[model samples]
Target: MGRRDIDESDFHSRPTKRGSRPRTKQRPEHSDAVTGLVTGVDRGRYTLLVKDPDDGGGDGASGEKIVTAMKARELTRTRVVVGDRVDVVGDVSGGEGSLARIVRIQERTSTLRRTADDTDPYERIVVANADQLVIVTALAQPEPRTGMIDRCVVAAYDAGMSVLLCLTKADLASPDELRALYEPLGVEVVVTQRAPSDDETDGANSAGQTAGGMILVPESVEEVRERLRGLVSVLVGHSGVGKSTLINALVPAAKRATGVVNDVTGRGRHTSTSAVALALPVAVTEGSPTDTFDGWVIDTPGVRSFGLAHVEVSHLLRAFDDLDEVAQECPRGCTHLADAPDCALDDWIEASPEDERPARAARLTSFRRLLASRTGSDA
Candidate 1:
């Protein structure tokens, strides 16, 4: 009478396993895949610098060729951004009208990301495998926002990259205030003011010659160059911060369009629409025959807000090695916010001598401010 009672597993679990399906699907080896570095990304196209097979590289000379490529159909969901190292197949020749297919993306060493706003859950990858983050802020004209700078610094630290604070338009204002704020955090600060161009200073019977005007090079430009010499740096800032101007000055051949600040609104016009990586011009010595591509500069479009909703407290803390060590004494599962009970950071700051208190307090304040930002708070 119990014949009707049965289970689905009874029929599937049989003595003979021949009827079962294969456990795994075979994937292609792609042994002949060619490697290329992504230099730029358009709507659906990618500009890659393919390494020459025959060349033994010392800084990527003529052996590397720039090629245009598109993602292979199988990689429909993958996002290929600038600074990505990818494996390409088919038509890798960097010839006229030649296009290739990117089949696989190599593991990234680092990825910088930001959200549209504090509440946005979606994160956009700013750049991949960048070694440094250059936060460009204008000292005057459009004015600088310390909040924006803090966000950029946190993003850099979260991505495991070094930070550089580049204050532009020093002619209009002094970098003293900003420098004092960031220097204690161990962020390198470089201040620059546009040097007077020759045309502006030439007094050869000029009808109207301004003594000081815009110049191609600034006083601190050389220092900035030296800092960026061997690192892959990405520049980020809000609109009208002179990011484009700084880029143009750094790479003369870049020819990136510059915009003017609106008189009433105090905002700089957006110049760069997309992020593009440009090779830094190599330095030449008298007896040297080879040219060395020193580094790459990735110029990104200006953003009004840099959201950090996707970031976690652990990731942010990792950026501050000193704080991370002090945090080990904190209670288990400590939030480390300003009001967290028995938070060790508070005691750590108090234990410091009187002179060191101010600087230590500033760092703790900055860290907490960033932590507050993660939860959509302005604290």
Candidate 2:
């Protein structure tokens, strides 16, 4: 059969002009989008916990659903992290194979950030909208590094979030030294002792030496829960600090993999690779369950170091209210370090009552230590 005359118009030799229509800057408002809490992120997919709008104000199992989502093209340059409150559209039903699109990220109330090290200039946002920063450290085995804890506290303070020092493995070592180190800063410290397992025996009643010759009674997971019941707390620490173990204990269903400290290196194996937010279960009191607690815990992967290259030394003062007040009296640009000429901190410490002089000195020392850490100097 003779081939039909080719219609040149149907087959263009050159590519047609794409995007022929003018684009408008106006974007969809997505007014119907529902607000969701980012629970996890893996690759390009996000896991969001969205509450049912029709369920009234109650937060029951049926009132909430987990929806898998991905960022929309409009937000390609915006980074999304766990604990972010995002607005999602498209398929929001928590069903198999259903995927939603994140249209907008709500303005973050707080952001926990860090850098690769003190010298790195790029800031890495660790978590968004977290109200509390839990600095977990092991009392023994891997041993606690005050340097990392200081860096974490600085980051938290810079982010304007409250700090909580979670000292783990109290049975292995005493938390006294560490507690004394942070006490002057007014940081809330919670020491935890893992109960003896079936093969272990309770030793010396798990009592440990603390500051001022006082004994510290280690708290259990329940006590930790009480501290975190109503806040969004992020757990951060180097490996072997028991962050994953603590998460498992707090939310039994989390089942986060726990790692042990390497006998030779004394470093913990990186078990959790990414950050995830887990909802705390309702507390059981007096043989009854209550639903008032709506706290969430974000378990982050263990890190060898929490860099603070992005933190400003001046911002660290705000964390110490007492020191900040005295610092105001110093000359402009006063670093408040001991060597700053005519630094008001020195005069303030001297003028302090004799009984309060020791505490004032310690606080000044602690503040300087953090400032020095920013510039890679030893206190």
| Each candidate: RMSD | 9.5, 5.4
Q: What is the TM-score of each candidate against the true structure?
A: 0.85, 0.88
Instruction: For candidate 1, report its TM-score.
Output: 0.85
Q: In candidate 2, what are the lDDT values of residues 160-231, reduced to their tens digit?
A: 999899998788889989988998887899888765333232111112222122222334666888889788
| lDDT against the true structure, each candidate | 0.81, 0.81
As for candidate 2, its clashing pairs are none
| Candidate 1 lDDT over residue span 200-299, tens digit each | 4421112111123465343366667778888899999888887876676566556677777899999878888999998765542234342567898999
RMSD value for candidate 1 = 9.5
